[model samples]
Target: MSNMQTLRFYVTPSHNCSYLPDQKAKTLFVDPQMRISTDSYSQLSELGFRRSGGHIYRPHCEGCNACQSIRIPVELFKPSKSQKRILNKNRDIQVIRKFPIMDHEYFDLYKSYIDQRHADGDMYPPTPEQFHQFLVEGSIDSWFYEFRDTDKKLIAVAVTDHLHQDMSALYTFYDPAEEHRSLGTFAILWQISEARRRGMNYLYLGYWVKACRKMNYKTAFRPLEMLIDGHWTHYRQE
Candidate 1:
């Protein structure tokens, strides 16, 4: 028996749903900070546990099913010429993996990302403590990938989790000052590379909202499979 095989779970009370308008949402979470094995984490992910911060959660809302778990099939991933160019453009950036941490620099970068990219959003001007709580205090296999330049300037960071068969991208933010670099796309490309290196087949990109321009970029990744009605349907690019 592996550590991940152990059963541990908790349910959250209904909260105002962030995804859909006028819908209440509840979540069932498995704390990764608890004494769970890596095997269990993989099992939970297959069972629909999406990592956020340090928590693994599955939708448990009553009667509402707007939330869906999504993953990208790495075997079929083929970078377009433009994506390859973006990768080439960011060739100088270095990615370092570290246990998630809350610090002044990270908080500042987060604030800058929010202010520039999501000013009218709920996370606008998030307090340091709040940012820490959201990014650090959770239960599950989570880590942060920090992207830096030659001078070690922090350009971007992505908090993600490793599951048995896949990697789940939790949240990512960048300096915003380096817009020309397209850090968001670069980060996803890096995750794909990391996933291939880890021998994982999937990279779980949370969701793709058709109506949201901010989310529309996710569709640009080739050979992605969107979760539809509990099935991963292949999406082809014309």
Candidate 2:
């Protein structure tokens, strides 16, 4: 099953939670020395692990299990009214997929997205080295989908990884000024559709924290499956 059971993982020191305020988070990551193949990475993904550039990890908090890895079953995915509107609104933008590289244009848009939208977050004051390490480096096959306006100006970039039966979204950054476009939601919709088009079964959206407002949008996609206690089950909002 992709040599997953044989790999070793280590835990990271506790750090401030990126989603919940004041809460600490620990992550379990695949051993850095182990070489990962596409099949092995896909197997690891099935276990709730996610890619973070050079490393693959998932939340390993000692006392908390707030982070639930979520994914969209592409074939069963039905876009809601709002998502359809987002698709209609972004019809003008062009989506092009290419190898994951530190293109100057992509980096510039990433810088802008961080500077204006996430200035208060940890990624504020973005740097070239951080960009390369956090988004460009990975063990498995990965790529970037560049979203451009009519004038060919880049507005969004989705860093994604191609795995066994699913396409995992590593990260997505768009022009914060294009808030009206709802690019973030649109990114997921497009990914879902694109994954279906490519014969993929699922589109992994990473973790969804029930109490985190920032993660509330993840539930908007119907029939979403969340990994809880090592089992993937459909999430029904109560």
Candidate 3:
């Protein structure tokens, strides 16, 4: 029998239906800081709880399952010819993983990315304290990946969770100045490669919204799994 302890809580619905039109949105959160082991935390992730701040959350709307938990099978992930081209385009960039730390450069890049990409989004100009709380206050296994150019200029950053069987990409941001290179796509490709190198199976990408073009890009990765009706089902064009 599985020995994973669980916690339950409900969040008030958001006034604006960001993803769905004229629909109320609510969520259920599991706090990893509250006596949850890394293994159990990974199980919750498989059950579709996305790590944010320090909490694992899955949608619990009254009548909606639009928010799908998505993952990439590292073994079956074959970069499309275009994806390979993107990787080759940015081969000069270097990636490093470390415990999350607050700094001005990261904050600056974050702000720039948000202001340009998500001007009306919730986290437009988050302060350092708020960024730190969102990225560093968790008790579960978490870390940040920093990407820099040869001159050590910070270009992109990803806040990821290392699960027992997979790597959960919690959040990521990149310099708008590098838009031509498609840094966002490169980041995911890099994670998939890193996961295979570390002997991990899956890369948990949070969600995919067909209506949201910004999110539609996630579907470009082949051999992905989408959670539906309490189960993860594989998806591939061919």
Candidate 4:
């Protein structure tokens, strides 16, 4: 029997929900003391766990099962018409894959993104310590896709984690000034392309909450599979 089944788990006490307002949420976390190997990380991802900094957790809210783990079947994904336009719009933007780094340029982009775009969120007034702890300090095999304009100025970044037979789309941030570029959608489309280019099987998108307007965009990717009741089922938008 694999130790993956025996790994220790902990549930965090209820806290305010980040996605749905006026609701409580709980999280299930793997024991922080355990040294998770790449294989173990992949297994956890398969079980709907996501990495936040070095912590791997999944939503375990009481009376609220709205957060469903979602992923794209790389080979089966067909971009929508709008998604195609987003790709064409960003053709001038160059994407470079690089290892995650803690640099001022990256932090500046993140701070600007949070300030202008997510000011009402918990990450408001983003700090260097918070930036490092959220995206840089993770132990997972992670890399970032740096999106730069023709002038070579940084415009956006896609933080991703590599897993066995899959790639996890962790987070994406962009210059709010470049709103017309729709960099967020382009980032995911590019990841799906990159994942297929590498012959990977799936691209794990963290979670989808139908009632959360912020999370509804995740279903834009076709042939999406959602982990429901411990099973991955095709998602049909009704």
Task: State each model's C-alpha RMSD to the native.
Answer: 2.8, 1.6, 2.4, 1.6
Residue 159 lDDT in candidate 3: 84
lDDT of 3 by residue, 27-102 (tens): 7766444666778778888888877776767788776677788999999999999999999999999999888878
For model 2, what is the alpha-carbon lDDT of residue 183? 97
Candidate 4, 175-219: lDDT as tens digits = 999999988899999999999999999999998888888887898
Residue 157, model 3: Cα distance from true site in angstroms: 0.7
User: TM-score of every model?
Assistant: 0.85, 0.95, 0.92, 0.96
- Candidate 1 per-residue lDDT over residues 171-226, each given as its tens digit: 89999899999899889989988999899999988865454456767888878776
Candidates sorted by lDDT, best first: 4, 2, 3, 1
Worst 10 residues of 4 by lDDT: 1-10
Q: Report the number of backbone clashes for model 3.
A: 0
- Candidate 3, superposed: residue stretches over 4 Å from native: 1-3, 11-15, 31-33, 236-238
Best by TM-score: 4
Residue-level error in angstroms, candidate 2, position 36: 0.4
Q: Would you list the C-alpha lDDT of every candidate in the order shown?
A: 0.80, 0.89, 0.82, 0.91
Reference-based lDDT, residue 22, model 1: 69
Residue lDDT tens for model 2, 118-205: 8998887999888998998863778889999999989999888989788998789999989999999999899998899999999999
Cα lDDT of candidate 1 equals 0.80
Which sections of candidate 2 miss by over 4 Å?
none
Cα RMSD for predicted model 3: 2.4
